[model samples]
Target: MASWDVIVIGSGAGGAPVAERLAAAGMNVLVLERGKRFTKAQFEDRDEIEWCRRDRFVPSILTDPHTRRADEAAKAMPTTDGWISSILGGGTIHMSGFFLRARPEDTKLGSRLKEQGTTGHSAVDWAVPFDDIARYYPTVEDEMGVSGIAGGKLAPLAEHPMANRAEATAKKLGLPIERTPRAILTAARPDDDRAACAYRLVCASYGCPNDARGSMLVTYLRRGEKSGKVTVWTEALVTKLEKAGPDRVSGVRVKRLDNGGVEETVTAGVVVLACGAIESARLLLLSGEGFNPGGNVGKNLWFSLYVDVNAWFPKATMPEVMTGSPFIHRSLMVGGALKADEQKTLGLDRAGMLDLLWQHDNPIHRAERLAIEGGGTLWGRALKERIKQHFTEGRSMLCEGFGESIPHAGAYVDLDPATKDQHGLPVARLTYAHHPRDRKVAEHLAKTGLAILKDMGGQNAFVRVGIGETLILQGGTTRFGDEAKDSVTSPAGLVHGLKNLYVTDGGVLPSSMTAPGTLTIVANALRVAAGIVKQAGAARP
Candidate 1:
């Protein structure tokens, strides 16, 4: 059996930072990833079918299926909804890189709900205050080469021609809008070998061929390898965590995907699970009952609620819409705390942010939408004419609103009793139903966004609420808290009953904030690494 001081599973934003920190601290670290390690040359292709339509990033749902339902009463059906990337750097490899920080109020959601007299929700304040994690944000930004102003953290990329007009419109309407910070590099740095952004505009679901986006594969994983103490095993799936005693994880059992059904047991002094929220929770439940003393292993799973509002502008009115620049780069965060009237009318606690961006440029997606709108019968000359009009007549702007989904008793994940994977292991089953207040918050934000688009001279401004959960930003399954009775992990990210088992992913987050959870996950991973290093040093003597 191969042994190491620490074994970190899943080299995403969460695992990579901790692995790099531990290796830099002179501890031998092993990282096991379930996906293949593709080189920069492999990611250079720009095929929409390979990157977006196919199962290159995510697993094939037909084989490794997950079942989902609105509630426990309904029979769960097979779905591909919650799968993020199963690659070397996980979802960060194909992310849009909207690196926004969580507001201070987001850290103390339990206190905010209590103050507002909100009931029947499972929201909890973080074990540590936001300031404890704030100090690590700059480290993440600096290492990832985030491009933005120092104090304001908002620098608009000059590639987008529509930014000036959007800013002017927001200012005229007395709405507060700020430029968003992205993880993509604006200029080539001195020490880094990666190139600057090419403004290709096919960012969200496509891998960056130029390495401009600061994915963990190109950043922390590379740094960890340079430390000479970190070893990464790609295409390795950890199936179970073996226990040393009542409160210690001895090692992990791994299955090699590249090999033909080869399995091995590897020992480690410590184990860290960073396989995002869904898979991390599934692994714990599969390991047995020893790690579930609190019975809180797979509970309180929450996903960010997404509300999309789109508006169309004619080419004659807004000529900038036809400029072919996909960067809008603006966000509306003016609705901070809810006013007295808003609270009374909407029955909500707070408001969320509205991110403005140009509509996706996928031709297939646009054609499908047109086909659906034309009753699925638009073909031949009509379809060609519609496609031309869709491109030349006008362009659509999208305002994506991200709101907090309050964790409730109804939303969670567990092992499916009937559905098993190709390896005969039980698959993860998700039971989710949005809180009623989630729709209200989303609707409020959508209305605000719609008004902004109309103010900007948008012709067909409309709002679409309750577009379901944003699975990529999920969290709270193994939430960390001060007490073991309610949370699966401690404030330092250690599992409740295990001394050496930790979770350094979004699963340890207690609440899903209004913004993306990637930055917070990275910052918290650094904080957890510090705690582990300090503990290791104290035990050395």
Candidate 2:
């Protein structure tokens, strides 16, 4: 059996940074990825249908074998919205290409809502503050070759600290634009020997071939492999965690997906689950041998309910093709309480509160084009008529909001006793239901989005409330806190039960923050790696 100092599962936004930092620090690290690894040159750009289809990013009954339902009564069958990305580089390889630093207010989750009369909400602050992550933010950016300008009104208000190539155009259009901090490298570094950003706009949902976007294959894994301290096993799905003693986790059992039925074992001193939220929680629940007593191992699920609104302009604005907006335009990013009646009117209960916006690329362009071509066949003609009407009198926009799904006693992820994966372990069962708080946020964000679109020159910016389902950005399970009994992890991301076990993914977040968790995840990993190093040094004789 192969053994290592640390074994990190999953290679997503959270896991990559931690693995790189640990490996670079001279620790033997083994990164086990459930999915196959692909380099930048291997990323497919020709299959727009497969790429645009939500199933491409997530398991659509092939790998995962399960689908989500709106509710228990809604056939209790399968459906998907494709929020998560499974890959060697995780979602960063196929991100929206907009890199944003968390604003101060984004960190101060509780305070921001109270100012907007959003009372009775349970938004909690992050375990670590923005100042704690500030230095690491730039460090990760530099390593990732993040291209951005240095100032913005969103996130940190003080002279924003990044720039992007698209900043000038959005500014001239009088839009709330700033220099977008991107995960793409704008220039070359002396040591890395990687290519730089080519200023191509086709980064969203596609990996950059020029080694620009700082995907994990180029950043963390690259550095780790170079150190010869990190061994990454692709398509190695860890099915179970083996326990050597009451206080120790000895190794993990894996099922090699490529061979289809081979199982192997690898031992490690410490195991860090960096799998995405859902997979991490499911893996924990499946590893029943581990030290989880509270059964809170897979509770506190959270996801942002996305809302999209598109307007067809008299002329093609093609906002979606443009790079991400630099400024977050906080006027629309509000969260808080709402009257019951108000929630019902705006379809808030069904869609969740959403942030508003006036631009975004809708992948349904082909369908929209069919309608614009005057194909008066069945609903086709009506679609074309609507397209024509919008072409002359309408515009395209998208408003989306991430509703906070607070931890609940009922909502959790567990091992499905009924279904098993190819490895004979129980598959993940999600017992999630939408919370009223999220619905309120969705409703409020939707209404606010429509208003913003109007203000931005949309005559009739309507609410195309997204399909309201409890999607999984997935974490808050195995949450970190001050006390072990109250949470699974410490503030520094060490598991409360095991001294060496650390969680460097969304699973360890204190609670949901309004900010995009990618940068925060990387920042926290840096902190955790530093702590591990410090602890190791303190242990030396």
Candidate 3:
């Protein structure tokens, strides 16, 4: 049996920073990962099949015999949507490197829901404001070595750096578009000897080949190892959290996933579970004795539904390839919420597809032209001629709607009684729903998407096909709040009843922010680690 000052589980966007900071502070930190350690060399030049289809850079869900059903009607079927990585780096390895900081208004998600005439959602606002985390954002960016132009014209308060090419395009268009802030490193650190981002452009839901994309494996884990204060145990699947006393977590019980034969117990003074939204809540629920007396542990899970628009052009594909997705038009993200009945009546439940032909990198204008011309069908040579004409006309653009999902109490994660991992512990089961306001957000975003394309010169521009929502973007399981009555986590990410326990992950999101959730998750860990360092110094004095 080995004991340490702190034990952090899961090494993705959340756990890595905390472990690195704690180890640097001289605390004996042990990090346990359920997957193999991957390096940058393994991710280079892989095609969509190896990368996206096989999830070579992402984590995988355990396919144990017993899977949980989302509802009673679907009881016989096991869920495949609780998709998470089983690899060492976790979801960060396969994350789309598109990054943005949540806006100030994002902190008041609950208030917005109420204003939209929503009543049944359980989503709550964040305890801290965006300004409080502002300083910490730079720290994470520096640590991860992000690349971009700072304070560009896209979003006024988007103070992070912007991509160079994106900035150029936005400037050329004289549109509200601007370069996006990215997690990938663009320069070298005077303190460390790691490589910078190469701008591979394949950052669409896949790992970066170079160490540039700021994956946790390169930044935090590598730095933690260099400090020699942290010990990493790979292939150790944590099954149970053992409690020493009523308020203290003593250690974790883990088993080897490969053999299912080896069993070990590693004790620690503190336990930080960052396994993710689904697994973290499941573990706490399985820990049994009073983890969530308020029953808010796994209650409020939300996911963003994605709607993407693609375009084609007559010119060479080279120019369009160069721009990459830079401008995030967020003005359409807000509108009065729509009821579920309205959504159903509007026929907004499935994914739809649309095509626009114009000059390469100018789909926005063509989309506007299409909207004006109603629509026309083309065949073979005629289609080729039309594409050439559109290309010369300089009209075309790709617009998408990434909508928010309001948190609901009915959405939750529970331990499956029948299914168990290799350690013989219960498997995690998740249940989520897009509440009325969440659907309305999607509808509004769709309408705004069309408007943006039309404004750009699209004649027959329209929303992408399908119900315009996706269940992949998850958040808010271990929500942070000022009062213990409302959330499982304190503002600092420490569990309410437990002193040494801390969590800094997607699960701790207090509200569904307007930006992609990873940046905030990493930034919050940095803030929490700083607090830990300050507390440790006080204890020494």
User: In the order shown, what is each candidate's alpha-carbon RMSD?
Assistant: 1.9, 6.2, 7.4
Summarize candidate 1's per-residue lDDT along 1-541 as a digit string, tens digits.
Answer: 8999999999998899999999999899999999889888877877878877889988888988889988988998988777778899988898988788887888888888888777788889998778888789888987987775346343445546677777887788666777777888877754666887788856778778888888998888988987789899999999999999998999999999889769999999989999989999999999996877588887999998788888888888777788755678887763346667777898676878788887788878777666665246787888889888887888878888888888988989999999998888898999999877787788788888888888777877777454567898989999999888889999898999789999999989988888877888999999999999999999997
lDDT of 3 at 529: 83
- lDDT score, candidate 1, position 403: 82
Give the per-residue lDDT digits (tens) of candidate 3, residues 361-394.
3234343444444355445676556656765633
Candidate 2 residue-wise lDDT at 11: 81
Better of 1 and 3 by TM-score: 1
Q: lDDT of model 3 at residue 535?
A: 74
For model 3, the stretches where C-alpha displacement exceeds 4 angstroms are 45-47, 55-73, 151-175, 189-191, 258-261, 316-398, 454-472
Better of 2 and 3 by lDDT: 3
lDDT of 2: 0.61
**Clash totals in order:** 0, 28, 45
TM-score of 1: 0.96
Best by lDDT: 1
What candidate 2 gets wrong by more than 4 Å, as runs, is: 54-56, 66-76, 79-83, 103-130, 151-179, 188-196, 199-201, 316-395, 466-472
Per-prediction TM-score, please? Answer: 0.96, 0.79, 0.78
Best by TM-score: 1
